[model samples]
Target: MYYKEYGNTGMKVSAIGLGTMRYDEQDVKAGRFEKCAEIPLYALENGINYWDTAPFYCDDKSEIITGIALSQVKRSDVYVTSKTNFSTLGDHPSRDDFRRRLETSLDRLKTDYIDFYHMWCMLNLESWERHMEVLYSFFEEAEREGLIRNIVFSSHMQGDDIETVVETGKFKGMLIGYNALNHRFRQSGIEKAYENGMGVVVMNPLGGGMIPNHPEAFTYLTEGTDLTVPQAALRFVASHKEITVTLAGCTTKEHIDDAVKAVENLEEYSAQEIVKQFEGKGASLNNLCTGCGYCKGCPKEIEIPKYMDAYNQYIFTGKKKSILDRLDNHWDISKEKVLECIACRKCEEQCTQHLPIVERLKEIGEIS
Candidate 1:
C-alpha cells in the first residue's frame, strides 16, 4: 500500500485505511471472534497501518476483536483510531464521562493510547458550540498526558460549521463524506481545510455502496479505463491530493482486497480527470443518484434519492407514469405533498452538486 503525508501530523498514513464499522453481524453476534478478526489481520498483512473503529460498531464488540487482531501483529506497526460520543452523555457531560469512554475503548483495545481519538458523529454546528469547551479541555489534557496522539472528528455535515472546526487550529483531522457525487458540495471547504494545514479523512467513498451495486448507472466510470465502477469510486476519493486517508468499509476479505487494488491501479490524475469529465457533460444527474444520501434531513422527509431515481427512470426509459405511480403509491410521496417543501434550501446546502432542488421539485412530473 502507498502512504501519504497526513497533514502536519508528521505521520505517513496508508491511502486505503481499514474502516471497521461494518463488521459482519452474524459473526459478531455468534461470537465468531476469529471470523471477525480476519479483516484487520488481512489489512495489516497487506501493509495497511491505519485501523479505524468505534465503540459502537458490531454492538460494541468491534473494539475487543480489533484489539485482539492488532495485538497479534506488531503494535507499533499500525496506527489505532477510534471515536467517542461525549455529547451522548448529555450536553454538559462531565470531563470524567469523556475519560470513562476513552478508558473503555483503551481497555477493550488493550492499548495505552489511541493514535487518533475522534468526537464521533459531529453533525451540527450548534451542538459543537455547546460541547466545545469541555471537549477542548479533555482533548488537550489527553494529549498532554499521552492518552491520544491526535484529535479529530467525523461528520456527515458540510459548509460553514465544519469550516469553523477546522479553523480552530486545534483539530488534527476530520472524517467526512466525499465521493464523485458529493465532492461538488464540499470541495471548496475541503480545499480550505488543506490550506489551513488540517488532515482530511474521507468516509463513504462509495456513496454508501451505490457505485459498486449499480455499475450500469455510472457508465462514465468505465469510459476510458478497465476499472469497474467501484474501483473508479475509490480512485476518485484517494486521488484528491489533500485527503489523508480513504476509509472504505470492508465487511469481507474480498472487499478489503478490492479497495486496496483500486487505489493501487489507478493513478491520482486518472481519478481526478475521470471525476472532472462528469462535472459538466459526461455523467448527468438524470443518469444516477449515487444514493449517498448526503442531501438528507429534509424538513418534509421527502426521500430525495427516491425522487432522483424516478427522475432518472423517466430520462432513461421515458416512463413518466411509472415514475408518478411509484412516487404516489410505493413511496407515498406525491407531487402535491412535495409542494409542501418550505424551500428551506438545507438539502441544497449539503448537496455538493448544487442540484436545483426547488426548481426540480416543480418539474418532478413534467416530461422532457
Candidate 2:
C-alpha cells in the first residue's frame, strides 16, 4: 500500500484507508464477528493502516467492530480516526462529554488514543461559528490529555464557507466530497487548504456509487481514458497533488481489492487532460448544480438544489424509486411548492455557475 503524509501531523497513512460503514450490516448478516473482521484485518495485512469510522455509523457498531479487529495488532502499528456530531456536544461543553465519548469509543474499539478526531459533516458558516469555541477547547483538552493526536473536520460546504474554514489554519485535515462529477472544490478551497498545511481527504470519491456502472456518469471519465469508470474516478481525485487520501466505502472484499489495485498503480492525470475529459462529456444543468445551494434563499421557498440532486441521482443511476423515497422522507414542502416555480428566471441570474435554473425546475416539476 502506498502511504501519504497526513498533513503535517507527522503520521503516514495508506492512500486506500478502510471505511467501516459496511462492517455493521455485514457482521450482522454473516452471523459472526470474523466475517466482518476479516475485511479490515485483510486491509491491514495488506499494509493499509488508516481506519475511519463514526459514532453515527451503524449506531456506533462500526467503531466496535473496528476496535475488535485492531486489537489483534499492536496498537502502535495502526491509525484510527473517528468523528463526533456537534449536536451531541451541546452548550456548556465539558471535558466530561469529550472524555466520556472518547472512553466509550476506546472501549468499543478496544483501543487507547485515537489518531484523529473529526467534527463530522459541518455544513454552514453559522454551524462553524456556533461550535468553533467548543470544538477547539475540546480538541485542546483531548490533545493535552493524550486522547487524540490530531484535529480535523469534514465539510460539504461550497464557495465562501469552504474558503472561510480552510483559511482558519486550525485543522490538521479536511475531508470534502470530490469526484469526477463533483469538481467544485478544485478551485480555491482545496488549493488553500493544502497551502495552509491541511491534509485533504476526499469522501464520495466515486460520486456515492454514481460513477461505477452508470453509463451517463461514466461518459465523464471515459471520454479519452483507457481506464474503467471506477479507476478514472479514483484516479481523478487521487491525481490531485493536494489530496492525501481518497476514502472508498467498499462493502465486499472484491470491491476492496479493486480499489487497492487501482491505487497501487495510480497515475496522475494533468490538469489540462482532466478538464478536457470532463468537458468532452457535455455539460448539463445537472452538472451545473454543484449542490452548493447559493441560490437556495429563494423568495418562493423552493428547495432548489435538493430537488436537483434527487433528479440527478435518478437520471444518473436509474434508482428512481429510491430517489423518490428519499425525497418523500426528507422533503416537507407542499406539492404546490414543488409545482409553483413561476419561471421568473431570477434563480438562473443569481446562480454562481450561471445554470439555467428555470428550465431545470420546470423539468423537475414535470418529473414530480
Worst 10 residues of 1 by lDDT: 281-290
Off by over 4 Å in 1: 269-277, 281-368
CA lDDT for candidate 1:
0.76
- TM-score for candidate 2, please give it: 0.78
The local distance difference test score of each candidate is: 0.76, 0.71
Off by over 4 Å in 2: 24-26, 29-31, 220-226, 269-273, 276-310, 313-363, 366-368
Report the lDDT tens digits of candidate 1 across residue range 1-368.
Answer: 87887889888889998888888999999999778988999988887888998876888898998998887887789899988765445666788988898899898888999999887776577656656766778877988999999988887566566787888887888888787656766676677678788888888887666556557766675667677788777877888877779997888989888888877754554334545666664344323455556688998888787786566555545677767876767677766656677889898665534467766666774533
Candidate 1 shows a clash count of 2
* Pairs in steric clash, model 2: 67-109
